[model samples]
Target chain A: MKTFPILLKTELKLSLRGMDMLIFALCMPVVMVLILGAVFGDRPAYDGASHTFLAQSFGAVSAIAICAGGVMGLPLVLSDYRGKKILKRFWVTPTSPAMLIAVQLTIYALYAFASLALVSLTATLLFGMRLAGSPIAFLGAYLLVMVSMFSIGALVGGLARDGKMAGALASILYFPMLVFSGATLPYEVMPPLMQRIADALPLTQGIKLLKAASLGLPAEGVALPIAVMAILALVCGGVALRFFRWE
Target chain B: MEYIVEAQGLRKTYGAVQALRGVSLRVQRGEVVGVLGANGAGKSTLIECILGVRKPDAGEIRLLGMHPERERKRLFAQVGVQFQQSAVQERIRVGELCQMTAALYPQTTPAAPLLAQFGLAGKLRQQVSDLSGGERQKLFIVLALLPMPQLVFLDELTTGLDARARRDVWQCLKQQKAQGLTIVLTSHFMDEVEALCDRVLILRHGQTHFEGTVQQAVAATPHQRLEDAYLWLTDDEREDNA
Candidate 1:
């Protein structure tokens, strides 16, 4: 539709002006890569793996941007729009609310990919960190992680009555996922009981899949991760659609 | 008679409180109809139902000879609305907001001329959050008119405006009326109603209590002034209900 591009362009412009989230989502992962790669250069992973620490952790670190944007930034913006009646204004126009939601999702997806590229390129060029996994498999797993994480955001934004509630819910999910899901804290260093707790989190499975693909190892026991991410994407995405409020 | 809007026995309830109780009215084509009401009189609720923003619990409503619920896309394409509490994103620029809105409709008035007409030519690149309230109101008017709609709804369009800014907005509405645009407005200012409305509808306790010209409204009450007449009508309704 003609209106999609117009909405996308305007939305992107507005997003660029408020660069706080953009910086966090796009730059934070690359920053993490630089810091971690420097501090632990060429050191073996604590899991007794042959690859350097950076190579094993790069896939998980790349997912930090998606978690930030999808869980926190997306819901906050959407709920703020609804609270201010921006969506209500659009509801009376020829453009449906679904179109606006689609545009927002596309924008976040672009951020996710851009963050991935920046982190990958920086790690490869600076630290000789290479992804040993199949590129196609890595990409597929990355997309599944994005969809699953973003669906949680859609549910929060769609159901939250105001911005305050959305922010509260997003923070509750965002911080724990960032720390426990091997994004901020390396999974290999955690104790056995901590690993079990981390594994219970939805994002941990995604990290495992990414780690396997990035290490070029056999994607053994991938069925469970795939099923969990798929079910989460379906359930959250379905509920969000069902209860989506335009205003 | 061709009615651009028609509603019969419309009712809405929010929990135990009734917002609209069997309210109904009709607007003929090309008429500037002013809706006046007290704070809790269901003026916004009625407008929302008619615009298909909310569904009425019990009523049949039509806009531009089409059912609002069944033909919402078509109805929205032909109607423009400015709400009392709705806005674009705060960071969007004036020109960008106008362009985005224009892209939604099949036809549009040029954004540049419309912005200039609303005295926003210099504010084209200004962020919406930076504009004063009156300027934001004017920008909303520009957006509402960009669609070149057949019917426009403005709810409390001049609530917070100063006298001069209010008049400027009124001047823009007068020009639109001159171009044969039908407008449905809600306001507390009797002078505004007298200056622009061809007919007036007043609501009390969620029902239509008076429907006529300003002159008829004045003539019906012991007081001849439009403001006094409005007060008398509302007080009369309160007394009757008591």
Candidate 2:
């Protein structure tokens, strides 16, 4: 229990002291929110929905930070540790792999929560958008999506041996989620066939749950998305634990 | 006296290369054993097997009368290890590294005293990246002794150190040995083996060609220097390559 906090502090220090991953994780999503939100501010979607483009886009855009941190950032960090034999050093010590993984999850979760606060506050104060759903429900949905996406990151990062391989796997997971899961491309605008495929994506279910929660929609139809998210969380989490190579 | 480490008929193979083949040896308590081998010899593999990082295909290994592979956590808590080229995390400060290492041991000595003993008290705040090669190696040695472990594994611990720094580490090892700690060290430098190890194991082609004191190993060859004797031992294999 005590080791987790020490490891988390070390990881956070590592992230902040280093420029590359921190810049990408903290600044990239915020930059995207500002740029995309500015260009499409208050414009109606093609379907003439009641919500402004800025509001809808920003709500969906918040999901991008989760995706980037988990799918892109997490895997690379895991793989680099493996390649550099960092985990090997820990293997000879009392530190368990579970402890290491728990630390990583905690650090990323902290970042995810920070990102949410930043994005939501910015959208509300600067863009005149209102949060539509129960705050508790929205918070619950965000945590679930973060867990599901981090599982994917851990699986890719733990299994891959090098940064290049991890990066490639991350791209395969990130691009589809960014484009098809309604973060960058609204699901309503996609072709019907593409929509069906998007429905199968982990992030698609995640975004669906998020949107449904934020819009105050009933939880009845949201059951499928929740189930998918749970499955993704379980399966990826299990595989990552099983196949992780320390060195 | 009871042996601190004992292994028999250890065998391991990686793809086409045979790392250890029927290799066996024993080290008594408080003995400082040096593993001397050519680059391709199974020294590292043997150390890995002893550390329980690599499972042997055919062998019985006992460290302090317990099987290391089956009881890894228990064995690890009592053993200290300094690996090859372990100074890659250069951005971390020496003091922080020491503190982090101390957390893993149930009973750990304070870092300040250890640093002071190593003449590194002034460099505790220096980043690992800024340290000289010898200082970095010394830092690893300090970490290895953080727990005051019963059995310590120093794999090439003095590889890149200068003569003075290498002598400093050897003195520390001698002090530790005098206090009844068992030491198992591996090094390619023949002089290091001569200076520190009480007994040396010469590994060739994944087998122990010689197992005796450094003087005995030296006496076995007609040549004077241990380096010459070592060359003589591996000369046949080099000819086979030619």
Candidate 3:
């Protein structure tokens, strides 16, 4: 539709102006890649593991952007617009306010893909990190993980009554996963109890799925994580669609 | 003459409080009609119902000759609106918001000239959050006119503007009415009603208490000024006589 491109461009400009996502979604992943490369360059992931620490963590660190954009960037933007009645303004126009949501999703996707590229480039160039799996497989898995993570945000954004509620919900989802899901701090370094706590997180499942695909390891051990991501995507995405409000 | 808007027997209730009690009015093409009301008198509820932003509990309404509820998506293309609580994206520049609003319509007036008309010519790069209240009000008015709409609905159109800015906006809207744009607006300023509205509808207790020319409304009361007449009509002491 004619409205789509204009809305997308406007949203992109607004996001760039805000610079919140740029720092968290775009810059953070690259920073994590750098930190991983510096701290554990050339070290194997664990005894008898097929990939080095940087290579293994590459998959996990790449998900940093996904977590940030999906949990924080997407919901914050949605709830802010709704709370301010910007969504109501668009609703009175010929265009549907769903276009706003679509544009936002597109922007986050752009951020996620750009973040992925930056993370991959930094890891590959700096620490000689390489993806061991099929490039196509990694791409598919990356998108799946991203979408699944975003589904959580969609539900929170759709159902939240206001910005404050959405912020509280997004933070609850974002922090534990960022710290213990192996997206930032190494999953191997967390205490067993903490790992168990992280395992309950949906993003933890996303990181596990990405980890298997990027390492080119057998995905056989990852069936649960894959199912978890797919189910979360379907369920949360369905609930969001059912309940999403324009204002 | 063809009516650009028509509504009858509209009723809406929020819990036990009746917001609209069978209110109705119609606007002919090229006429500027003002809805005058005290607080909680259902002026906004009526507008929102007609525009399909809120559904009436019971009513028949048409906007732009189309059923507002069923054909809202198609009907809204021809109507421009400015709400009192309007807040655009805080981080967006003035020009960007205008461009975005323009993009939503099939036909549009150039944003620069509209911005210039509102004394916002040099504010293209300024963020919306940084604008003064009057500037923001003017900006929204500019946006409401951006689509070159055949009909415009503005609620509390001059609420925050100073006398000069209000007069400037009145002059601009008068030109638009001269160009055959129909307008339905609500205002507390009788001077604004006198300047722009050809007729006025006064609301009391969620019902259409009076509908006629400004002169007719004024003649109904002993007061010479429109504001005094408004106060007289809406005064609680006069309720028993009416």
> Best-fitting candidate, measured by DockQ?
3
Candidate 1 per-residue C-alpha lDDT over A84-142 given as tens digits, one digit per residue, 9 for 90 to 100: 88788777887777788888898888889989999999999999987788899899999
Work out the TM-score per prediction: 0.97, 0.90, 0.97
Give i-RMS (Å) per prediction: 1.1, 1.8, 1.0
The predictions' CA RMSDs to the true structure, in order, are 1.5, 3.0, 1.5
- In model 2, which regions exceed 4 Å deviation? A35-50, A184-201, A218-224, B87-90, B161-165, B237-242
Q: Write the per-residue lDDT of candidate 2 for residues A170-220, one digit (tens) a residue.
A: 999988888888877878778999999988888888888888787677789
lDDT for model 1: 0.89
What's the lDDT for candidate 2? 0.80
DockQ of each: 0.79, 0.46, 0.82
Q: Cα deviation in Å at residue A195, candidate 3?
A: 1.0
lDDT, residue B168, model 1: 89
lDDT: worst 10-residue window of model 1 chain B: B85-94
Docking class of 3: high
Each candidate's number of clashing pairs is 1, 0, 0
lDDT by residue for model 2 (B1-242), tens:
79888999999999999999889979988999999888889999999887778888999999877788677667778888888877444267777677767776667888888888877889977887898877788788889888878888999888768898888888877878888988999998888888778998888889988899877877877888888887876688755887
Could you tell me which residue pairs clash in candidate 3?
A: none
